[model samples]
Target: MKATATMVLFPELQSENDTIASQLLLLPQNITKNPCENDRTCNKDSVNINVVWLDSTSHSHFYRSMPKTVQILRDIKESGSLNVFSYNLMQSLKGGTYVNTVAFTSGKIFSRSYLQSKKRGIGNLFNLFQNGGYHVSMIDDLCWTWSAANCACGIPTFMGVKTQSWISEVVLGKRVTIPELWGNFSKELKLRGLNDIGASLANCEIMKANGITDPFFTGKSKVAICYNGLYQTDYLMSSLELLQSQLNRANRPHFSYLDINLGHESTGRRIQTLDVSLAKFMSFLGRQNNTLTFMFGDHGNKYGTFVQKSKESKIEMAHPVLFVLASNDVATKLGRDWMRALDINQNRLVNILDLRQTVLSLAPNVDVESFPINAKYDNHPNGLFHPISRKRSCDSMGIAPEAGKCICYQGRVLQRVSNQTGVVVLANFALGELNNKIQEQFLAANGNESSGFGNCRYLIGSWITNVQQTVSQNITITEMDIHIPAGTGAPQSEDVFSVTIQVGSNIPALSTNIKLVHHERISTYAVYDDCRDVGVDGDLCVCSATPTLQSWHIDPPTIFGYISTVINLTRYLYIYERRTPHGLNLETSCDSADKTFEVVMRITSKVNVGYSKKYPLTFKVKHGTIFFIDVFYQLNPKLNWDVKYDVDFKQL
Candidate 1:
């Protein structure tokens, strides 16, 4: 046998004069019979979930005219079935202010129906629920339905007076009944005793005393409903805590439903302000194995107001209500089936009205289809109906079909500035002998003395020197100087050389018009060598050669046509002399000699002066056997590499 389930219907904006009265008329008939014959329990099923529509209209006069509804609620509670209570309460804050303004301005001109209906409905609902005997309760109040039309004009003004009077009567143990302002319309508007306000508080205390803390009241005779009122942050926080605490204490499964009206400023802000509270509550619900919960908005509100004021008939205000239901154990067993049935894409036109049916379907021994509304209900057809999809009219503007790409709605456009300009091409190459050989080969083959390294070289060569090298052994001396002899016929003096080894490289081809005055001076030298023969007994040798300049000025006379000689040599000779008769015999032989040479050369290179170019000849040196030369240039009046560009708006 299946366990009994409960259903609660909480409706906001249900008027007592017409809507409420008609719904109440239909409830007794609906509750008496089982509409579905397939299920045997349908015939004998008890009402697990009860529906209580709060009549907030009577709040101002609840002490006098709330007996009927109160009696009805108590009678339902005595049946040992679940009581599902649902209703909206007056937003004492917003409604009261609006009501007072209208009453004061219109005086006796305003129809009494507006205030009378609201007062009666709210007063009756509150009285019924407060006195109703239900283990669980859901109050749908100011959280949803924030329109001023739903509230009384004198709410703010009358609530304080009424609350005090009600409290006094409660303390005095008096039956504090609201005045019958509608029919009799002749109740004295006098202040009540202190005991009236105390009585109301006493009722609250009594309700709290009987209230079960279980949020998911899975047992029989439990009540769950929604509250409709303007929910402030503090109120919501307290409400959630109360619900959570009740669920924790009840030790039985229960569910609490809340309508998050995102369109209501206070309600929306309440959720946002206390977001963590809601999260904690949801997490608690999720962990309860026996609980099933649902949250959603009844309908969307207008953009500027809580009420729909536009005259145009559009579905924008009616489409796509958000629905979320969560359960642990039940979901684990029948989650897929339930999801399939509830899936928006399955073409089910489920709306606020379907809430009752869904809850009834989950109840034990209840046939959801037996209800007339559920029986005649044709599920929304495929493609035409979806839970998450809503059809909106396309604009008639010239914008493209795919112009807007927003998931929710269009937002403000953000303007941005373009920071990209011309492309900067960078070609990185090895900085050692390999790159030097490539550059030297290109220069020697394309040398043009007059046209500035000619067109083959776009920019002068620059050196990134004093680079720290990583090696185990140092084979060469720490510092070595290369000297260039001066003038044509002058004997090449090794000591008095024209060019001084100024710590670093001197390459003129790199100089540009923008950087003609500045030059870099080398501070130190760094060297690296491969330890090829670590344990070998022979001396390690390295060879290098380069050309030098005879003078600082360009086109100077060539000295000895650039002499190349073996610059370095180290000999290791062996001396062996036999002792005896041959007197002293000496034989000496030397090992292979290490050699190096320097050669001077003049090359033409191009220098860029902003947008223009000029030809210049630069002096450089080349290695003898290595067949590579590294050229480094110094610029005059240091150049600023910051490039700027202009874009034509017309082109855009």
Candidate 2:
């Protein structure tokens, strides 16, 4: 017995021409012929794939943000027609949208170095579908620009099929004018009654008409329409309608990829607005037996107030939402064991690579049972067609640190290490790696560009705000929040970065001790105007500032000190200056035999102090029972001073 679901739609939001629900109701209730006799008999030409990639939405977020959509999905899953993967981890947490897309499209692991290399010749799933005589179409705003800016994975022509470009003209209204490459596609949209969508996008006029007073859209390009008063569902509806147009006349099979930036803005809270459209789309898919839909997200929130709202918000960035909806006929063809595997893999650690493999398994003449049902490492892809190891580690899945920390294991928890010395060293090291990546990206650009490396200022580590780590079996994973002076425009403003690194216990070998796994700028870098097209992570760049007069007032210089627990240490060093010197240098000397630890200096400025700043030096010696600290400072060659002190930790 097949279960039925109530169709949900927002009638007030629909146009008069013909409702989507009404149109779906007109389709055949049952497929006349089996698209594939069984899983082993399906040809690519007989299987239709409709993929909807939602940006910045995670598994937890989907349920919290869209209760209506979740209920609809639950109904489908209960009907035994849908398979939901509870643990679909993303390939990259910090690589952004472009890197994640390329990973699944090619079914390969992507790294910052790989994207920087611009290596080509890797075949993609789209090309496979095209070669199998399937009609292929991709709809997105920035997909084309992202492809052109990076590797040439044949994005424009996947197997020589020209991708449909729907930028400025369709995505942004005519208020923002730009040339359209595929002009005929716009006409096709008009014929399909989707011409109103472009005009309905949030624009200056629309904002005024709707009485929206938020300045969020002021400096942003017309393309960045997060809180534009208009619901983002407009783009989703248009894409689904366009896909519907193809299905109406599809002779063989059709593959349509809809990658939209609908839920990326507003801390991803905007996903709630997609409930009605999403419910309708899923309802329509429920009636089709030959089509398969992959609805998922790239990663979670990268920035905004929402990420700082709670701990769950921060963790969701690595846990993207993935739902695979298969028709009843397709499910039956895949067999009972495959269905069992699907049930088991939902809770296992899986990613886009596995999704790609599962799609390929449906290709023509692929024996479904050729691969073992219980094999740990199947020679074939590790898709849901077989079981994914519950013990899978991120490294085994070819995941890099840039993707985010692994959450699959139970005992690998990252706890606070309380070592300020180690935090400072690792923070600086991570910043160095970030800057090197920025420099490499800048150097890769041809000299034709005006905004080059010279336009951006290199970032420096200001202070270590938070330090955390977890060690198990001699392996350590450390996370830190470091502050830097990469702010928008304020004189004393700063930006905070969250970094995660892995290290071995070889404290003596600090040179090869720490490795950066993931890093993200938690604060906004809106001041990236000067170096707009520099081709590097814009947040990593701080535009160079014009020369300004520098002055500092130094009252009688004084030093303060205090001693706390062995696990906690605090020291304060205050410096006041009247005139800025050519340079300032800080040196530290320790009277301990072991050189495993070092001192860290934190710099701060106070506007109330009238041109005076504070410098607090903190030290930690983990190996020695007792140690002496000597510090020397020089405002300039003319001014020099030194402070020496020793304390015994053995008494504590």
- Relative to the true structure, candidate 2 reaches a TM of 0.63
RMSD of each: 36.1, 13.4
Query: What TM-score does model 1 achieve against the real structure?
Result: 0.28
Report the number of the highest-TM-score candidate. Answer: 2
| lDDT of candidate 2 over 315-385, digit per residue (tens) | 67777888877776666777788768877877776776667678777655444345333222232463777
Full-model lDDT for every candidate? 0.25, 0.49
Question: Residue-wise lDDT of candidate 1 within 2-82, one digit each (tens)?
Answer: 001121222335565653411100011111122343466432322212221211122222212234433433443354221
Model 1 lDDT at residue 214: 15
Q: What is the lDDT of candidate 1?
A: 0.25
